[model samples]
Target chain A: MNKKCTTDPDRSYKQPEFDLDKYIPGHSVDCVIVGYENQQLKILLVKWKLGGPWALPGGFVGRDQDLEAAAHQVLEERTGLKSIFLQQFHTFGRSDRHSRFKEQMDQVKAISQQLGTMDLKFSKWASQRFISTGYFALTEIKKTCPKPDFLSEKCEWVSLEKLPELIFDHNKIVDKTLKHLRIQLNFLPIGISLMPHKFTMQDLQKLYEAILQRPLERSNFQRKILKLGMLHRNGKLLTGAANKAPYLYSFNLEKYNSMVENGIGFSYLGDKIL
Target chain B: MNKKCTTDPDRSYKQPEFDLDKYIPGHSVDCVIVGYENQQLKILLVKWKLGGPWALPGGFVGRDQDLEAAAHQVLEERTGLKSIFLQQFHTFGRSDRHSRFKEQMDQVKAISQQLGTMDLKFSKWASQRFISTGYFALTEIKKTCPKPDFLSEKCEWVSLEKLPELIFDHNKIVDKTLKHLRIQLNFLPIGISLMPHKFTMQDLQKLYEAILQRPLERSNFQRKILKLGMLHRNGKLLTGAANKAPYLYSFNLEKYNSMVENGIGFSYLGDKIL
Candidate 1:
């Protein structure tokens, strides 16, 4: 807040390269960059550069580019993260969904103040009836840097429990994404992808507990997960506990990815005390 | 084709009630009406009035309507069906997805001939970059009284096997919906919603076989399905076979719905023969 940040809101205006021919006007792509750390689920949000509420980092799709590719581009541009697990869950299309976020208009006003120009065409372009597609990505939080786009002031990862007041129905989108993630957890072996290399059985259990919001019996959880054949036992972790240390494990990426793509048959057993 | 039906492509032109304000400019809703009967899956499609390729029944959404409601309205307007099971699966948003359907433009060209007027404004409105949300519904084929809209020549229920080349990417949309449906079959007890009121185990197994696209061992499938506790044993059907009569079952709607909302743990048990 003291020094001028490298990024500014007027980057697009600074470079008058686009004339609507290079962009898809009435559609946008938003990424829900979800990361897990310290047993807490967090999402990355960008504060609009000009004094507005936080918004899911999003951008317009290019005229010739695929919607999915545009989401990846936005993800990379906003967070500097690449090649992570991304899924397109839903598209928000209520007519008034975008219009409900009046606070975001302050961003336009601030841009006008900064640039010393009140461009009506820019305002109209911003206020168009835009239908947005939401893509969610799961990445290791500590592995990459998150940089805000030229239109945002800062990039922050906020915990799901204390999420700020998001613009529009982003909160709803996040909720839907969480539900989808939890559902996928039942069928997809995401532990390895969401975890670091060589973690203990307790660490894996903690991840499952965080997502499922329920406790699992140590023996049963280990048996059920190990039965899937997606994990490889690697030595042991000294947890300083009274009992024997749990075995260290790493997921077989090939097996984990195949299960993610074609789903593993592990959801049938209820959260029973097996 | 024989009667020169009262409905035609120029119907909208005949009524000048609609202005530019009536529709949400660049978003639409499409419905994949699926029905199961005779141990096969089928989908309902509409043909363009001016002799163009067939398409899923779809319509531009109103300026202030929810996208899901628009899908249901489109389904009823085209199929005379209401209050059926509908799910929003995905949204299609490729830049060239809408523009590549040049053959469908013949309908607009035909409208110009029938009305004796060239409506350039209509053509411009039709060529906008529209993004569409896809919704799917399952209903009984025999009970449906499918009726085409003013812009469609006829309504037909096409089997998935002999599906005709559809307009735009509707075929792809249907294929995607089927994949989602199959994945969901692993989680949802849709047998009751997709079947007649009271059906025997053989009938239910046939439906499962149709969806799973493989044979299920008679005893094991029955045991697995019954274990879900979402089904109620009604009576027995005398198959007149050399064995015992197959029992009839109807889904307990409340249990079935709860399972649908929170997926039934049925996906893990693989399609293993008894």
Candidate 2:
């Protein structure tokens, strides 16, 4: 059932030899690194070399490594983004999570065997049920350098609205992350993490609109956000229509940090939108 | 080094024999079932028969069981409360989580050996590194009937203020759960789950005070809660002083459920308190 493809004589993307004894079995970590660019919300996804479906960038936990540290390592390896604040949103542990991907797994095994990298122990270990912890982070799009892992051939940003069918339960993980982000909008540093250093009021509003997926009333949104006292009003952008040029603003770091530390009530879109 | 106690020849509290092959190793579920009583917040804790420190009710997951189902089973086994909503707040996965309790675990082994239930497989499995998921639930105090597990001799409600040093990282888990509860106060069904069918406004305020650990302004609290329109007034609470009696209120289930589904801005206590 393996799909035939041109083999790389140098084996640049060959699977890394794992010391199965050095890692704990039946537990793994998956990360959803989200970024905003061109007014669209995006997540990092990886595609396996053997013509399989896309999946989140994930790896197993080391036998002695802290769980948070393991998540950090995975984030760095996949995105070249280090020390980003990744939050553990949930743990998914359905016994049949892997059973749905049986055909794809069989194809992976066949491809690995053809490449002469397959071992009985690794095959058995890969087939066991896993209880995976999901962690997510918001990042600035320009700051990341995405790279695929050893087993995958491509890593790219896919818009949330057009996400392809992901392997296993990764799509559910992304949905849960979005729900958590919406609920925690007031507490999260969305502007600082996802937007440019200094942006026009419209730029900030569009970012919120993208996340909330609804158009907020302009005047109301501005009044409530300014009331929080975390934004510094900069000079207006000199557009062709000078009077209509909306003022630029940037986050006042100290006040923003304080408000984020103790959550603010910035839910101006109200209960219906949230 | 085992603490000696009068052992029942019938071995009523004997350790249950586990089929190691039927369960997943290196993972467990710990529950923090918090209940409101006497104007204080309390959590269920269990004391081991061999004189170890108190711990949350916990057990291993079956190889074929869903993670949440395992958590529910643990909750039902310890509290005799069935089918209550249990939320998984965080997963604690430090490699050395059990290292701090080496002496206690050794004592457990010695006691189990004396009781003739110490199998080598079980001992080895128990000593390995475990990554435990922490689940929390809010319930009415009168509804629960606490009972200890096979390894524990006492299961009782312990006030949060007077909690003893718990085994492993359970104290940290409780702190995380409280922070989550505070952040989610507006979205949770606190009144429905923790209050009586008919309660004075004073009782509802007391529950929030216990959770926030500070007193809120009475007029402001009443106004904000009333604005939400999720409580039904059921006449005055008849106390000795009729003129000073506060109004009784019960949750408007339809409205309460709607507000919970779509979150409201109920952080009237201000950002400083949160």
Candidate 3:
């Protein structure tokens, strides 16, 4: 069978030096699954499987898996989150993200050895160069029960503005994902999974403001969002701040899904009738 | 100083290995710059520098250059087309787009050797594994004076629908770029660069329809597109074929650019505006 594989007419031996280290040299996927809860946008991250560094939850692709599927699998494993809104935003292939991290691996391994559970082979494997694709997602924070994987110590939600120093170039990856999410928000129903079942206009706007990192003009933001036509207006929220109660809203799931399928191009700067 | 450089205070080595076949494998960027002319979306391609196979206009990156700049340089080299909107849509990193063209390389090399002017060393180098990043652009077909680089025999614009079987997985890359372009069309002023300076409503609609590869309702398409408020009505085109003269329009570049900068959302489908 091996001889037949080597002489197969359809598939020839191209790069015979198929060392896992060589061919699998520099490519990976890192996920930044951002969720909204209590009117805030939070990102799911994991502390290092081995060390103290925190990072956007990530995993390397298995030999037989599609790169994208590997990202979703990583999301499920690290965050206990499944079938959420996931998307690939960017691929970070800078030489520095890999090489700089490799430079620190020996020091990290030395630190681990002193802690008394070090496996040198795994440490070496961890030190190899990698180019990672970035996938972002929006989910309900309360729905996910985050757990650190074999390679990590903790999994937690980190506010985008208050993110800690991350391992490798994960901070940059998170930043890129956040930017992509904000741009997508301008055209997509972003809070469907991120927000709770019922939210006031202010709650949704706060989530948007947090993701955008900019405070929007209130009346305009509310009017524009309501005009999208996917939100189902519900009973008023009895809030202490206002005598006139704020109306609660939920995504009309069927309409929202169909809008996503067809796409919603809502340019705020465009026609007023829309 | 040289000896001290070998063992710096920071580390034992400042430079990592730069092996062409190993560390810094042969990487190239192929530009699938698409242009619309005569109501068709077309791609710019080049014949191989060595021989028969036609592929997207592509070139290698210098060790010191940014990956993005390398793509733009390749575009400029092949088309003398400078600074029309370009984006890196995807990077082809599977170990296959490399070896996928190996069989064709062998046949082409054999023919060239028979011709007695082929350099075996160059031929071998040309066939080496390459991981390429794909960038695409929208530009005026008339403005571009396409020409092949030192490695190609021909350069020209080919209709996207009528493209020949391109060398390697270039056809796949082109397909990927087009899909990305379609998604990003609402955000970009595609009509500005891809269409002639002045065009009838049918011409503009046909261009969008061609890129989208779908039929659009005439009145609805016209209304949604014009509602964006970045088109200027010119006189009228006397279409010798039909009823009345369709109104000729020109894209308002300044307004179109501002819309792109300040997000344009298309929320035409379902109840919500995107």
Candidate maximizing DockQ: 2
Score candidate 3 by TM-score against the native. Answer: 0.65
Put down candidate 3 lDDT per residue, B1-274, tens digits, no spaces: 0112121122111123212342234467788888887778889887754557888887666554456777777766665657878888876656555565667868656643443233564455556566677888788877766765555667888888789998888889988887678767756767787877888778888987887777889999889889889899989877697788889899898888887776575532233222
Sliding window of 10 residues with minimal summed lDDT for model 3 chain B:
B5-14
- Per-residue lDDT of B1-274 in model 2, one digit per residue for the tens? 1133223323222355546676799999999898988999999999976676799988789999999988888887776767776889889988888876778668756654443354665666777889999998877777777778776778888999999998778888889888877766756657778897899878888989888888878888888788889899989877787488888999999998887787666764354545
- Which TM-score value belongs to model 1? 0.83
Candidate 2: lDDT over CA atoms?
0.79
Show model 3 residue runs off by greater than 4 Å: A1-23, A49-52, A98-128, A200-202, A215-227, A233-249, A269-274, B1-30, B36-40, B46-66, B80-85, B91-132, B138-155, B165-176, B179-274
lDDT of 2 by residue, A76-132 (tens): 877676777688989998888886777866865664444334476676676679999
Poorest stretch of ten by lDDT in candidate 2 chain A: A1-10
Best model number under TM-score:
2
Model 3 DockQ class: incorrect
User: In order, what DockQ does each candidate have?
Assistant: 0.42, 0.52, 0.11
Candidate numbers, best lDDT first, in rank order: 2, 1, 3
Q: Which segments of model 1 are wrong by more than 4 Å? A: A1-21, A100-118, A232-248, A272-274, B1-21, B99-118, B226-251, B272-274
Clashes of each: 1, 0, 19
Model 1: chain B TM-score relative to the native chain B:
0.85
State the C-alpha RMSD over the true interface residues for candidate 2, after superposing those residues: 2.4
lDDT of each: 0.75, 0.79, 0.69
Docking class of 2: medium
Identify the superior model by DockQ, candidate 1 or candidate 3: 1
